[model samples]
Target chain A: MSTQAIIAIGVFLITYAFIVTEKIHRTIIAMAGGIMMVLLGIIGQEKALQHIDFNTLGLLTGMMIIVAITAETGLFKYIAIWAAKKVKGDPLKILVVLGIITALGSAFLDNVTTVLLMVPVTFSITRQLRVNPIPFLITEVIASNIGGTSTLIGDPPNIMLGSAVKELTFMAFINNLTAISFFILFVNIAILAFIYRKQLRTSAELMANLMDMDEKEEITDKTLLRKSLIALTVTILGFFLHQLLHIESATVALTGAFLLLLLTGEKYLDKAFLKVEWTTIFFFIGLFVLVSGLIETGVISKLADYSVHLTGGDVKSTAILILWVSAIASAFIDNIPFVATMIPMIKDMGELGVSNLEPLWWSLSLGACLGGNGTLIGASANVIVAGLAAKEGHSITFGKFLLIAFPLMILSIIICTVYIYFRYLI
Target chain B: MNVAYKYDEKLLELKETANGDDIEFLITLFDSELKKRLIKVREFFEDNKILTDIHYYIHPNNKYQIIVRKDFYNEFLIQLFRQELLQEIKWR
Candidate 1:
């Protein structure tokens, strides 16, 4: 390997190690690692800038703005209450319904935002129903990760995949992954509901009390809701038609965000911007430059070459290996940086003789996104929910989450193994 | 039955009920400005990291509902007084 390649590998590994240790903030580590690459002459500053995927950052920022404002409208709480009332206030039934709602919400919004909105409502509903909230919280956390697997914009990994490969369009993700993701969601929730069925029971009196809640009262601002719905609709529609419209996903998202700001006027501008997870955005920015060092150094190509040779240039074995490895690795470490590194490697695999890259892309997406359900620390959504629940005195400890979620994650991977084998590999 | 708080309707109306060990408060604000006070009380609870201690809901025309745990009832009342929603508060 060239000296630059060796230095790039060293920088990348040190950065990855720091991120895994969780002692320092991940954004700081990622940014520091990226700066090292530039300062060490592994990659040029201008070339590193070119490597930053603005599409991913723009989409994330835009969606964050939209969800932040929409959240203020009390729409999420309204929907949760409305769904609970629909299920006749049965705790078990409410658990399933909330899981489904979480999945749907995460499919449209980001997983962390979806779970953040769900946690408070979960606590409120469980408190009212007089049942334990841990099951419901755990279910939502898993569902959020699975739900985030279904779309291009749902999970950070998928977003990176969509932006890195033009062929994997918004519709492409919907067509391939959405159905399988929901199928996994159903399987996971069924098991959760069965396990927690005993804890889900509540007195008829409590049920009636929950029923008495006025969901209509939850709409804090109808005017804002209407405008938000309009912007959200246009933005989603833009995603559906973005490929046909020959525009990038980031443009659609930013346009939708700015349109909402226009309709809502300047009042929401600062709030929306404030609500954008700038730390996450910077993390992505740093990761791009860090990965560019490896790419520019030809290290990623060498790894791809080795991987292709190991799989004997076989598509099925390579796809399965990628899928399983991604799932297992993502369960322990952050998937964003993992996917960032994999994207270039996979692209290189294409040049190295992988005739069908379709299955490979889908495998990476499924494995990385759904793999988060394996443990409490697997994904940001899981960690956020655990922290919030612990703060509320309902601790979802690492061991407890692993005891339940790990087996289910394995089961999910088994199902994916079947789906990928049948749907794509065949 | 315990009176959670006594408030002038001009500022806000506090209706209380007991559900097991928890107290539910359905607050209606007559003056639009009192919404800020209610928000302050909500922020106080959130700032303390006591998420489940209260559930705050909003209704049209400046109406709000908050359910408080019995354990946090005293603290909740103190917040109302602090935010000036309650003109005065007394022990006993």
Candidate 2:
């Protein structure tokens, strides 16, 4: 390698390590790294912007607006309440309901938005019921990641992976991956339930003291919810309808959001969308450019070549390797960019004649998604959830999360490995 | 077998009025959706008047449940619960 290549490698490693440690905001680290590469002329400005996929950004923005509108309807709250009444303030019920919602939401949207909305409600429910919210919250963080791997629009990483492979369509993604995704989710739900069973069961006569103080605010305007629901439903249906009918995903999502604004009369729309974290968008864009620097300078290709050789070009071996590596990497670094980076590496493996690329992709997806459950900083959803929870004064310590999260994440990964390889490889 | 709906709406007459027991009322339901919203709405009560708790084996089916303890039913809460929100789904 040339001296410039050596310097580039060192810069990338240092940035990667700091991000895993989460000693600072990833946006700061990633954006700084991308700019450093540009200043050094490792890549030009135009090249970097090209690396920054506007489709991913646009898709995310449109989806966020839809979720924002959904939140206004208090549907999540309603669903949560209905679930609790069914299980009756049971911790396991909280986990199951939260888990299902997180996974489902992540499948349709992204984990960050899903968890952002779920965490407070999780905290509220658990706190009211006088139980630890850690387990249920942890499940949401885990399920959201795992479930997000199923579809193209579900997470940034999936989107990056699909577009990197020649802009794979929505149906192509779901058809290829959703079955494995459901299997992973199934195992996750079962294992997490077992882990939190004890703490979730502590009951006392004084329990009712923990209930939330306001039922009134949940009663938002009726017309708003109805209209929001209609718009949101149409958008989701439109996503699935793309193969049979010609509809752009972005146009559908944005139209729903805008229509929601018009339907609800903007009063509620402004309040909801204002909470959208635009900084996250910048972070994704910056990281794309930074990773592009690696690809441009040939680091990604070299790594991919080495990875294929290391696994002896066996799909089974590669799938297992990706699962373990991604799970660990995701536990520390943000999974979106990590998964995004892995997509190209996997394609490179495919070029080297790696069979069963589908299973290998699923392995990477499962690892990153479930692995994020292991650490507080592993996924944006976790960080956002933890941050939002802290703002509510409930301190979900990194240490505490690891205590519950690590085992669940590992077990889930293992389950994923068996299912994917057994079903897909042999 | 008539298993409890994973969720249920119970009109508790107070764990007390059964003959004035100091602990008031204890309302229980299986794990389901209302669990979260019910918890959110709990904050409206005066601190000591209501209580809630999370239990793992709230049911024999291995699912969880949310049980609320309240001195008495609050009408405002009823109206709020009944509010035609997007879809405030509850179980019987």
Best by lDDT: 1
Name the 10 consecutive residues with the lowest summed lDDT in model 2 chain A.
A206-215
* Candidate 1 lDDT score relative to the true structure: 0.91
- Candidate 1, position A37, lDDT: 98
DockQ of candidate 1 relative to the true structure: 0.43
Docking class of 1: acceptable
For each prediction, how big is the interface RMSD? 3.3, 11.5
Clashing pairs for predicted structure model 1, backbone only: none
Candidate 1 residues lying further than 4 Å off, grouped into runs, are B1-22, B26-49, B57-65, B82-85, B88-92
Compute the lDDT of residue A178 as modeled in candidate 2: 80
Q: For residues A149-237, could you state the per-residue lDDT of candidate 1 as single tens digits?
A: 99999999999999999999999999999999999999999999999898888999879878777788667789999999999999999
Q: Lowest summed-lDDT stretch of 10 residues in model 1 chain B?
A: B1-10
